[model samples]
Target: MNATTPEDRPFGTVLVANRGEIALRVVRTCREMGIRTVVVHSTADRDSAAVLAADEAVQIGPAAPKRSYLYPPAIVEVALRTGAEAVHPGYGFLAEDPDFAEICARNGLVFVGPRPEVMARLGDKAAARRLMAETGLPVPQGSARPLTDARDLAAVAREIGLPLIIKAVAGGGGRGMSVVWQADQLLPAFRATRAAAGAVFADDRVYAERFLPGARHIEVQVLADDHGNIIHLGARDCSVQRRYQKLIEESPAPALAPGVLGRLTGAAVAGARSVGYSGAGTFEFVVDGDDVAFIEVNCRIQVEHPVTEMVTGVDLVREQLQVAAGRPLSLGQDDVRPRGVAVECRVNVEDADRDFLPCPGVLTEFVPPGGPFVRVDTHGYPGWRVPAEYDSLVAKVIAWAPDRRQALARMDRALAEFRVSGPGVRTTRDLLREVLADPDFRAAEHTTSLLAELTARRSRPHRAG
Candidate 1:
């Protein structure tokens, strides 16, 4: 509650208002920095690794996110009750919720992120697109505002030509998004996307954009402090995705065109500074050849952030905490020297053969990969039960090396070493392995559409037999 500078204010205690590996990730950093941590969790995560690692753990509610993690009031009450000075909404639930951030500010608890107004501006896809355009950055041609109705949407689609995409103005991670490849698909796609947006984000605002199916997904990691210092920690390619969800990510975007990374990095810092941003954020773009178009800004630390950290040697979460406490960035742009290539594979507890359905069960046998250049971030253990109520991601396995080739080889070895087994348990490990070995992926010619190709060719069920 004390409005003091970061250097004078002791950020001694922090309440983690989320669960899973991200919560554990934050807790680890807080511990290393000598900051006390309180973890808020649902019944599903009572026995999770994050809870065990925290200085204190509080049961907020049941397994349902709405009643627990997403319930801002309960989270705020818990922080106040625990005497925590700040609340860290580790990605996913409430991580990008501007209202929650404002609520934290109003209740005198530091939100370990950007200001609420800044989050609102960047969180809205359409608004972010407009902001990016104003910065003189290239943005995709699309609806400047939320389309009025299906007729308006149809008209815009016709003008933009076929194969355009309808996106929820308030959506992310591919949810509330629909691709319309033909004129007949416009109405259905628009209405469906609107309904999805309302259901997920409680906002039915929809916009449209030209679809670039083969473009690579590149995003730059950005850090900004309260003092107006913003810098980028290079870029990462997350083109290996399925259903708009990234499954694999790599840093330095192997084989990028000359001067592209520099441009992307510069634009990202510019975008962040344009909004007077703070804390950790990402500027996502769709890259086609040398032309890059801004897609959206992820106003929170991302799941694929480890790839950037692996190469930059910057602990983004640590910086985020410091920035939230009003500290300037520990490193400047000149100091952010990215070295080596890093690849990350998200291990999900899903049946890749059955259209990637969630296959949750006890992990009777759990073994994570490890080596000189490999790092695994997970909250699961041998006896831990994979909860069906939450996201299927169980762990993130990352590999780093001096070059892309060695990084890929190291990732393959790490995947081979990762083991998980139980009834009804199927992971994306084998699928990721197959994708990594594909000739197109090795050549770095894969795009956001690569998952569709892999899915079509999937013939075997990946089971831990």
Candidate 2:
């Protein structure tokens, strides 16, 4: 199956089937791993910073992802042409696609993620929930099947109670999801969610679940190998979010009770073991006070992976390469002890007050922060025109400190130093400043819905000095 045996075939050159900051992140690690990298780019991304960072770059197709990044055979061809032995899909766009992984395997190219079977098993949320529940993991009380037309409205309503979430079976990153507050809104919510899901994922299947109000969006970054060895890098507090997408994240979630930490870690391991989960993946959960319930599992590296890496000195992308090469995880559970606190803020190009709308344009004024405790991961410059075709995340600034308060102060200072500007671009930086300065957030007394309420309250916009 694998070229040569698991231990023999070397993980040589890697083809990064992604763009932007993640591609650059992987390329940097590949440089450290002494492995060459093949960077694939769409026409719109021909001048992307990641292309310059790679050992070799390839123009795959037009600007559309379906023609470039999502086209498996074309991407594989690029890998073959460039002598790339493996492929690393960073987060979105074919990262969790099972058929793509299988295709890479058949072509004798390593896919830097879990096996195709694992992805297929966990791709569907309802199915994954059932499997995890079978292993005694705590999953939300939800329907097993994607709603069958919402025909039995009353019965379904009685089953899931009020204030339930209507989610797409194949949803991720909050795209194909809707929340229902009352019985009257259920059918309309389901219709809208189904339409959105069909448009986004080609899956019109919708499911219902009891929404856990005030649950913290906590997750564990897990590393595993082919031989079934697994370990957890401490949890991240991603409670600061809007519409299920995290805005800021920090390691060693504050305010968790004594026994709650172990339970969260154990449940994550159990979920990983359930689908024979391997490679670097994240298991997201909604922690209701001290009680944790499984939300979903991301089978690829996440946007907030840096916080965990900063706190625990593990090069996740490098480890991902090693794990894909069929190498056993070099570090055991004890080796993953957390040392310091790390916080990451995602700087998105969006107008925060105008319904958080995307603000894409040329970077007229771009300046990133720097200090001993700060690290900025980005691929944009002053002349770079922010592409409207992709996600609005421009860059990430991470701060590390020996303790939470120091990390908080370092991040606050870094945010103040950081600056970005363009015509009519409304950013979340000022919004983040307000949220970070909040007493509840400073105390870590927040949840996934924190931003929703924060935005609902009047925000006095403060321009960067």
Candidate 3:
């Protein structure tokens, strides 16, 4: 890899890794920038919107992610075979995998993310926590290192105490974690968490931390160029979640303290700079009543990133491209500020009344929301087959407004406008409606477990048809 400056990235063919909405999102921007794109996919995503939109398409493997998207060597081989100059990993799968990034560089392909070393540094939440703590960031209080055994974990948790979070060293997207409320459950929790971590990431190095109950999830979006210029695109409030997975997110948290934004943003930028970070990344924080602590930083773009883009009018995907091309971030921090409130609800192919069970099939009919202040990022359409083998996410419906209430109203209206159905498919539209109408959400007094609470309170013995 050449050490060219940010403004010198190659403007040739780019291959897209991963699939679905994010893939289409990258491809559209590449076309707008006059860069040709090639789409690589597993058999399951062969009929996905991304494959149809790209200039060319290539089949890398079978339907499963492990066989296709996660196989770096095969992806690199496809890139080499297709003559693409760079590979755009649109989050998930290998987007944050440093090994894949290194492979891309070794194979003469621009990885389109931060340097591999930086990724390795930030990908491990525990290591990043210690680094940020050293860098003057307000990180959480937890095991400084990954506990080696149940006794070691118990000893550390005894230090941190009960009602703490047991986190995997290398974890993301709410996976590889467990919450223990009692000291007696430590051993069982540790064993289960270790099994989960090992099964998912092949890493069972786990740690413990004081869990912040009722904490709101806050994150800052930062973009940096190779020329040493880094700027934040404000924050997102992802407090509405279920099973530790986010369902609804909005920009400019409505309940944040007067000066909290500056603090989180500063820490986010400071943490990014600590690793000499480049490309687009998000610094996540768990917020208590008025206290904040750095949780983890996502090394790539997020699912709700479109909400920030909608309100701020910053094309994160485009900036990612330019940064990969060795181009300085076109806009500074001041220029990327939010103009209005934007809220995003993930439209998943799941039955709302059925424990959010996956409901994948061919889309018999589909129509996304559209209007002023409304943005729909999707990779599904009429006649598209919704694969059950991957994520349940089908689209992100976002709405922007000048104020929080207006944004909520607009989001409700947008949800009403959404029309998605299949021969035997169910969506979370009704559940989202319940969430939007919840008094706690409307009053801006909720946390990460709010949705699950609401769901459990209303969970019926059987699914409502």
Candidate 4:
């Protein structure tokens, strides 16, 4: 690999348009690359770690996300006012919004992701499916476009069979999705999903696909540059999820048939090149046995990125910044080699026993685990209050080892050492431990339904002897 010189630096100053761990994560990478950072936060996060670590900080709005992080105009204004040369929208909020990218471009500030046009086309799940299918990627059997009405949805659902998934065209992060198993339950599920989609994403368009009950949720990480260079960093297994939300993720998906990984990575790279995609993105797929089907693409840094970094030894954020600056990828496909096994667990401030309900309060004590091959990405600290206005994820604990068995053991040890407490505060630490010890997970045979099944077993009533 080549060293980045002063001239190679993408932007002298970058404005981070998000909050919590992702904001802090971006600031850390920028500092290492000799770039100054400006972070915009709501009033509730005035004392956040990202704000404290940044060279400059500004208050954008109140606690509400809509008035703060999701408001593109205010964030663009901050970047311009602060003299930031670029804006990095980490993961959520306005990360995938093409209009926000265009606004940044119109103001002469670089948006550290794909071009606005490409983002707009791929941001729509239905459209992305069509494009990927045309590019020779295997797409699930479903509607090729957004359903027009109840009749259209029913027609597609019938064609796709009884068990199908209703997904919002503009949905991500597990919201606006429902699985209908019974024919009688189709319309109600459609109505509820559409309502939730409109309220959350502000777009109500939806489509249906055949649901895979016993499938592994795998995603390939890819990085592209404007110079027509793209490479896959490998794949992550995000099968351990509840309510379609991923709780744990690991890289180099285990127990795959021979050549499955290669096929998935090749398809991802081809799909990215076909759409002229740039920056860091993820291609999510559902794998049932030896068969794989394309789902959607995440056109930004993912939450489980650390797992990829652990095994690949690549700084994805650094690559994103360099690509945004019109630089070709620093390395090619031949230079990319993944080693060992890595696992990451999202430690959220939620009570797992109470149906994963969010528990927010002041933290009386916060101590993350530390040791060899263990990384903790978080914005929490002692005396810092856990705000209910944002996502419940307080920290991410990652462990790497030479093999999957050791990695799981290391993660369990790290989770055991994680000490966090406060008034009315709870976390999913215990639940994650149980998952790490599951028999099916140990054999790498677990599917996306593992978490739900675990919860169901826990909720069953025991007969008295």
Candidate 5:
């Protein structure tokens, strides 16, 4: 790998090709880096914070995501028309889309992520599992390739045993996944997952894997440069989740056996290097006891990035910009140091009691919490209507402290003080508070099934002695 000179500045102007908090998150970093920003929005996001904060804003299309954010050609055209030197697909819309990255490259704009080929390789779940296993990362027992035929799927399921998971090849963000516990449910689950995957990701290919029940969802954050320098920023615990969607994330995953985290981070760096990856990415793993298995790789900035940032004090977006500009990583492994503990909660506009149903409407009043180490990343403001067309995520509240106990306390307090009220607007704030107060969570003994168990216990009727 060759290193570029320090005089080589990153893109002068970047177009954020997503909406909501993530788009605004990118714009904020660009502003601090002295780079001009252009944010493209749909009719629903015309008054979004990202659109308002950007140096320029473009109205791409109507409220429908397909007509706006997910449309690669229109986004590329906007970048060209606005003279944007690069395009930042913040996270969801086209973040993991290799074709979108290729389109940006063909148009001579940096895509602010891994190369298109690398993304295509790692974006597919089956291919990624194969590559990681070859790179010496432990993978769960399952089919080595995608299971497209019904007979093949059943055979693999029989081999892997019952209670396995069927996942989409192009799945991410917990979307295109199903768990099969009985033999009778195998074929139906596979066909359903395949159909949903095709409808969502345009790729119906499906794969099966041995599901690790009660495992901790741990992920290592890695940063690499064009110069072949790869380093892990440490690990994050995202075990508190419902329906496979993470609600809370914390850094320096608690209560791990000695050297477990070290091995996880080391393997993550090795896997990233194996693929010649460059940019900010995450290597997710499923950990049960001391054993860990590589799950999948997210080849873009993640939603839980703020918790890692809070502990490492590294601006991942800035690192991404520098690496995208063909520059070497500013800091090496020896220079990287992590301090303190941090926790982040995804404050979504949903009713947790009602099975997490989306409750979107105009925000009548919005007041985010603030303090010494509390950081709130949000795009909502009074009178801003939450669009039901997209994700329910409205804000990410993060808190940092010297220890996990203090961090949890700070997070609880921050959530308590957060004031968001509107017509038909509901948040997961109360449920998050309850999770933080759980004894298992406080002791870091929780697993990926914690949320489900918690909800089940709450709903169970008490019997009279």
Candidate 6:
């Protein structure tokens, strides 16, 4: 069967159900394509860049995410009232909410992502692990079903061995995860993990998995249209993270073990096709000792997508719009080629010196870096107040070059040139610079635990810089 063109299935108006940089990114693409955008914002974001740049802006609710972004009813109502043909949930909030996607469908609006069922299957961490295992992909030794009781949880923990990890079955980003290094820590970790999971995802279901220490966090960028055309751009190294939340990402993952990179990317494309996925998605994995284990799937565009875009020269947002419009992909598998190296550092309003504590305040001076091969994506201005209610991310600084060394050098210069500050408002600029200069990071030998281990060492009196 042939796929329809954009003209045959047009979504002229899209309601952006997100905030901050991602919303602005979507609006920018919509403007380029001559598609109107309706930005729904909370009271705190009335003056946000996205709201100001949008074709139309609507005050959805208060600053609390539950009332504004996460509130599906308000978002769906806004789309219908504004006559929006589709809703684009960028990255976080309701991006992977299966019920929210279903509501969009019921309201005669395109969800601008995979089907609700697909989201349900891929968004659930446990379910995704099972699906990947079923597809003959490598998944860590873990429980495929939710633990029913404390005894059941302990049994699974014992089965997976002592140094296993407890994770929330419903969500990720280390929101509800704990490392149990011994038998004594199992129950407490399980309880804490469940409590955290319930608080974040409204589900207390927890599972256990073999924890691989010093692993590299890598993921493949996948694009699949409704026409069954699936292609992988490449892999990204997201190993530099704090608390499992990615802080830096680079495309063409540096120093991948022999055959490991090809296998991971191939399995990612195959996984997407087997699940009948659509639009942009990411297949996340943890590489340990020449083995890659499937972790979870991000059902929407990722925060670090700019790295892939810089390297591939593909407008992922544009491809997503076309896919949602029922059009065939503009490029085939052979056309998806990556060139150059790209690195992205997430700039957040945190005091890295004070252990990365969140320090939000009005920005007194905000000067982003520029020049060749440098891109800064932000929703902040000189006097904009950095709100304390949301994620700490203030901007994303990206740099590209012909090779990884040059890319890193460019990113270092860009970070150095960039300036953002306010009263009691601390940023991670210095920390990123320090990391960039570290020999291990420069050599691509840094793993996910490197940052945490560095932080621990930094606290020691003898190792204080």
Best TM-score goes to which candidate? 4
- Point out the higher-scoring one by TM-score: 1 or 4: 4
Tens-digit lDDT track of model 3 for 277-340: 9999999999887798988989898998988888788888889988888888899876765787
Tell me which residue pairs clash in candidate 6: none
Give the per-residue Cα lDDT of candidate 5 at 304.
Answer: 94
Q: Give one digit per residue, the lDDT tens place, for model 6 in 1-465.
A: 324445643577999999999999999988878788999999999999999999999999999999999999999888999999999999889999999999999989999899999999987888889998999889998887888777887788767776888888888655788888988887888889899999999999988889888889999999999887999999999998887888889999999989998899999998998899999999999998698999999999999999999999999999998899898888997997899999999999997767789999999999999999999999989999988889999999999999999999999999999999899999988888888988999999999988888778667777557
Off by over 4 Å in 2: 1-10, 152-154, 459-465
Best by lDDT: 4
Q: What is the lDDT of residue 418 in candidate 4?
A: 99
Error of 3 at 438 (Å): 1.1
Residue 108's lDDT within candidate 5 is 95
Provide the overall lDDT of each model, using Cα atoms, as 2-decimal numbers. Answer: 0.91, 0.87, 0.88, 0.94, 0.92, 0.91
What is candidate 1's lDDT per residue for 326-429, written digit by digit as tens? 88989998898889999999999998888889999999999999989999999999999999899999999999999999999999999999999998899999
lDDT of 4 by residue, 385-450 (tens): 988999999999999999999999999999999999999999999999999999999999999999
Scanning candidate 3 in windows of ten residues, the lowest lDDT window is: 1-10
Pairwise lDDT winner, candidates 3 and 6: 6
TM for candidate 4 is 0.98
Candidate 3 segments whose C-alpha is farther than 4 A from its true place: 1-10, 460-465
RMSD (Å) per prediction? 3.5, 3.7, 3.6, 1.7, 3.0, 3.0
Q: How far is 334's C-alpha from truth in model 2 (Å)?
A: 1.0
Candidate 5: worst-modelled 10 consecutive residues by lDDT: 1-10
So what's the TM-score on candidate 1? 0.96
